[model samples]
Target: MKKYFRSGEIFIWFTGMGLGLSLIMITGLLFLIVVNGKDYFWASELVQITRTDGSKQLGEIVKEEPIPNLNLPDSLWNKGLMRMQMKIGNRDLYGFDFQWIDEREIKNTDLPKFASTIERIEFGNFYGFVKEILVDGDVKVKGEEEIAKKIGSYLDITSSIRNEIKDIEKSKIGKINYNIESLRLEIKKIEFRDKNSVKNKNEIARLESEIAKENRKYEMLKMKVDSLNLLASRYAVYCEDANGRGKTIPMINIVRVYQPNNMSFLEKLGFTLTKIREFIFDDPRESNTEGGVFPAIFGTVMMVLLMSIFTVPFGVLAALYLREYAKQGPLVRTVRIAVNNLAGVPSIVFGVFGLGFFIYFIGGTIDQLFFPERLPSPTWGTGGILWASLTLALLTMPVVIVATEEALTQIPRGMREAALALGATKWQVVRRVILPAATPGILTGLILAMARAAGEVAPLMITGVVKLAPSLPFDSYFPFFHLDRKFMHLGFHIYDVGFQSPNIEAAMPMVYTTTLLLILIVVLLNITAMIIRANLRKKYKSATF
Candidate 1:
């Protein structure tokens, strides 16, 4: 036997081992997802309806158990149907016979009951059991869009409609008072004519008749006001209610919602499938429920969007000035140093700056000058999406500036000289030749900025990281982006679930799920950038430095 260690063989071997380890880790992740969350994909929670006698008992069927020896030989087995009785009031709701068959068992016969007075019966599957109970509610679950529309409708119709009705009632009461006053005058006028005369009696009767009519009108007006008030109250309640189906424990309903599929479905779709069903679709019972991640997601995305919209154009322009036009002076040198230093500032410092400058000072000025109606309560003068985005953009400015400058520096002097040599203007040379060549680098920088923004939790926490967002930032409504409204983030979700949740046991799985989802999103974004970079490289291969 001969042993030969070729050049770079050790490095290659190490690389291979590293890759194998990564694959093993990924496979382990997939296995966990399959074992825990696969059934959650195909299986929608089934609402167990237990209606016996005149009463209805509504609750989630948390779990089902099976009776032992129910599958034994016919001679040994108890000769009775093994039906699980659900206690719904005074009556028993039994599971349908032979419907709960295990795959391992061949027999489809009646199961044994422990007693005929039967308060309990076991229901189980032979292979394994499902721990996640089905949740049901009295009302049908709605999606984000539907819920937003409903919320907007309530805000629109209820508030204005109720106000109008209230005004109408007030007017009607005034009219009634006017009528009563007129009748009082009429009685006073008839007082001198006679104590019991026929003319006086007729006048008194006519006045009484007028007063009775006014009273009826007033009652009708009151009823109308009350009805409007009740409607307005209900709408407000529904807008706030997470699980609005019923008062009972959520009835597990087999709901079909478009959700973000986990790794398995993504694999099946060639890693292209972006969305799959999740428990988040279920109406949330509380702010911490899986259904409630909407707020955090919304907030996080909004913050990032706001940051990008502000940073990119501004950062690019500033970089262009420093690279293309600005004279080499102490002032320019100082500015460059400042920009570089800004990148190194702790993110928490930006959070503090945002709290003071964006949230309070600038926002307060805006609140005072423009939005007088929303004043005192401080519209812009609050920790909101707008300030958070602005703050993060300011924090990320140096990164963009540095990346753009480096990209510009890499552009060969020959490229610019050639463009000028062709009689092209300086602006044309920069725009057509320089910037286009640097687009990929610029995009790469932007992608890096986005990744950083997505993972940022500290600055956001101080600025506007809300646990639950009432609405999404961008919506179908006018000005669709509601920067004032609070939003959600995956980073924050992991933090809150892992640290803030009271029931760590229950929230542990959710923390994993959320962490996994965040990783998937970041990976997808980076992959997209890689694709873009590859395309750019192909297009500009000959235009080298």
Candidate 2:
């Protein structure tokens, strides 16, 4: 045993075991997320459950578990009592989407073929059986089969009209609103300069005339939308719940209707795929308990890219000065210690600093100087994408500096001396030889920085991240990349859906899905950086040697 210890094989084996255990734990976590989140998309069989009390409930059975003994009598403690959780998702009627029922109370259960799950625009989902389809208060389809077919047709028309309404509201009306705000700001600036000028008065009158014309146009558009909404509401689907309660849901409000109990394997698979696509591509709805997270994904990617762009050059330059140019002394060592210590500081501390320094000091100054017209109401004088990126850049700067310094140190002194001996200047040697050799190391630091930045939620929340952004930072507008805009983030989305959502049970699936996507994004970024570093290492290996 002493010989084995002295041979260092024990330590090697111990380290290997630790690494293997870590891999196993990571794999298990990923599997757990997949099990919980992936199944959310698959259409489960809806069961009509009849209880001993003669009450009926309809929903998909979500989970079953052994009953806990807490607050129970001794006689019931070890009786092996079980309970099943059901997703009875008629939130508007039931006031809740889930319910727990004891196994003993569930006297009868059946997979009802006619039961339908309707995905809606509000109040989560509706689980019921279609009774009839009504057009203009006239029964157009009465039987289940006929109602389903007619409902599908009406839904298609409603969807198209909804799309048109959304386009008009977000595009044409949005542009008009923006122009009116700009004109108002222009008038404010003119008033600030000289309130009595005839020229300014005429300009204000012209702006007022344009605003009135725009208001007329907006009213016309609003009327058109209201008419379409009324037309869409003319087609209604009457559905009856398990308890025999009837509700009339407008066809326009329903997103999709499916009979999970009757769906075949192929149909279920297709439904699951469609759901997954929507989760990835659609904007979140119902307070982020449903729909997709495309906006969050876009914001996360944009912020990380901006952070990388800002961090790399500054970190590389600081590292170069420390490693190559700075005199090795007590001051330099102290600075190195400070840099190392910054990495250990709580991330929230950085968030506070960002809020104060970036948003208040720098952003306020910019707003005061450049956007004087929009004063009091902040333009760049508040939390925004630019400040968030800069804040994260500052937070991750230490890691990049350390990695770059190490890379610079790895290049032999002999190489610099040889370059100098060959009549090359110090700058020439650095730009041509040292930099080329250290590209991989610089990228290593960048990969680490990006991975950290991508997952960070604390700093982003205070800096610029929002629950929902009205528009993306990049659009067809002039100066397309609006760095001053507050944006959504996947990390923040997970935080919000997991902890801040009104319905935790419904949000759990979204939390896992967003977590998975975030992990994939970070992995993808690191993989791309690693590939570049590998190629660069190969290119410079011979030259360095």
Candidate 3:
């Protein structure tokens, strides 16, 4: 024990135990999030259709019966239909329906144990007029036979037409193949002769002429194929109509519902993973069926990119000035103190400053200069992508500056002295020698800044974040990116779903999943930055002082 104490192994053991405990705590938090949140990632089906107008209800499509499940104790089930309601935007939304059926309140109650199970549930748009009934009962579903018959007819007609087109395509392909074989024989004969021979030239020219003729035939066949493809796409889309009518049926205005099993953590985690995959790859807009997270993902990436672009150069330069050029004086001391103090400032304070200065003063003037008609509604003056990025950059500036300066300080003074002694220019020395050695430190700062900026919700909430973005920042349009637009962020999504949502039961899963997603994104960004830093360190290891 005395030897171990003298060698400081006891300190090492204690430190290691503390670090291990911290890691376990972090892992436990992540595990809880993964298990709780993954369910809401799946696209839920629309079951109950609630109409707008505060009037009659439209019919509900009960895909599956509701399974008897309860998470609460029996005391909570004594009251009648208890519902949680909330005001979202301009609408009053009703969430899960909690029923309290007491045996003492009712007489001769014989509730069936083997009732139909509800596989999934969704609430449709309450903003549209729904004329049908919207309640779940033990009656058989209507419109099956008529819809099936119409669908069968449409499929039969389209199939026959598609088959005929395919046969014609096959015939054209066969002809093209035969011509290719003939051309190959001519090429083989030409190859057998000497390159300088007149016989080889004659054979090559003849084969070329035949190939040109075949090309013309191929072009004609391709034109036919294009026309047939257009027809096939139209036919396929038409056949997908649930009612089998070609009339454009705008999707039933409905919110998605999923009948979740009270499954274990592992099953829920698997389900969540599947949902995330669907959200990423599947284009739900094709049928206007389900919403995906693509826009949100795009916005998050674009915002981070914009923030990094603005912050990195400015932050690095600021650090360079303070660390290298600026003499240590009262001004320098004051600046250092201010920079350190800035790091402790509440992020929301920066949000307000950004709103007033960048959004109002600078952006307002620009909007007035260019867009006179849009004076009141400031284009870049109001909450926007550019302003949000700028705000986050400013908020995270202190971290970058402090980190970079510390990195610059770590370089031995001898290195700089050697550069100056060798008659190298100051700019050249900094660019070639100092910057290379400091790359790792700069990247560490960048990763920290990125992590902080990505996780921040308050500043973005007031700046430019939206619950549902109208469009992504980037698209294949003029200007490519719309800077003057609000965007959805994973962090904000979590807040909106958890705190603001009326349906706690429904939103809980989404909250956890979005939180997990945000964590994953930050981790990935840090990992990428670390990899680049490591590569730079390897490349310039000899430059270290």
Best by TM-score: 2
Which digits, one per residue and each the tens of the lDDT, describe model 2 over residues 1-545? 99999999999999999999999999999998988887568898899999999999999888999988884578889888999999999999989989999888989899988899999999988999999888898888898877766677788888898888889999988888877877788888888788688998898888889888888888998898899888888888899999989999988888899898888999999999999899889988999889999999999999999999999999999999998899999999999999999999888889999999999999999989988877888998799999999999999999999999989988988899999999999899999989999989999999999999999999998999999999999987778999999999999999999999999998888899899999999999999999999999999888653
lDDT by candidate, in order shown? 0.60, 0.91, 0.63
For residues 332-356, write the lDDT of model 3, one tens digit per residue. 9999999999999999999999889
lDDT of 2 at 400: 98
The reply for model 1, stretches above 4 Å from the true place, is 1-276, 280-283, 329-331
Global CA lDDT of candidate 2, please?
Answer: 0.91
Question: How many residue pairs clash per model?
Answer: 22, 0, 16
User: Which is superior by TM-score, 1 or 2?
Assistant: 2
lDDT of 1: 0.60
Candidate numbers, best TM-score first, in rank order: 2, 3, 1
Q: Looking at candidate 2, what is the lDDT of residue 528?
A: 97
lDDT of 1 by residue, 1-545 (tens): 12435566777889999999999999898677555433222321222232233222222122345546656566756544333322211111223212332223322222111001100111211111111221121233354444423433434554476447746854566557756866765675566446499878987998889888888988888888777665544431211111122211111111111212212444445312221433443223333633335555556656776788899888899999998999989999999999989988999999999999988899899987876544466767887888889988998888888888888888899999999999999999988999888877777777888888888889988887777665466665556667776567789878887789754433554676666667677777668877997798678767843
lDDT of 1 at 452: 88
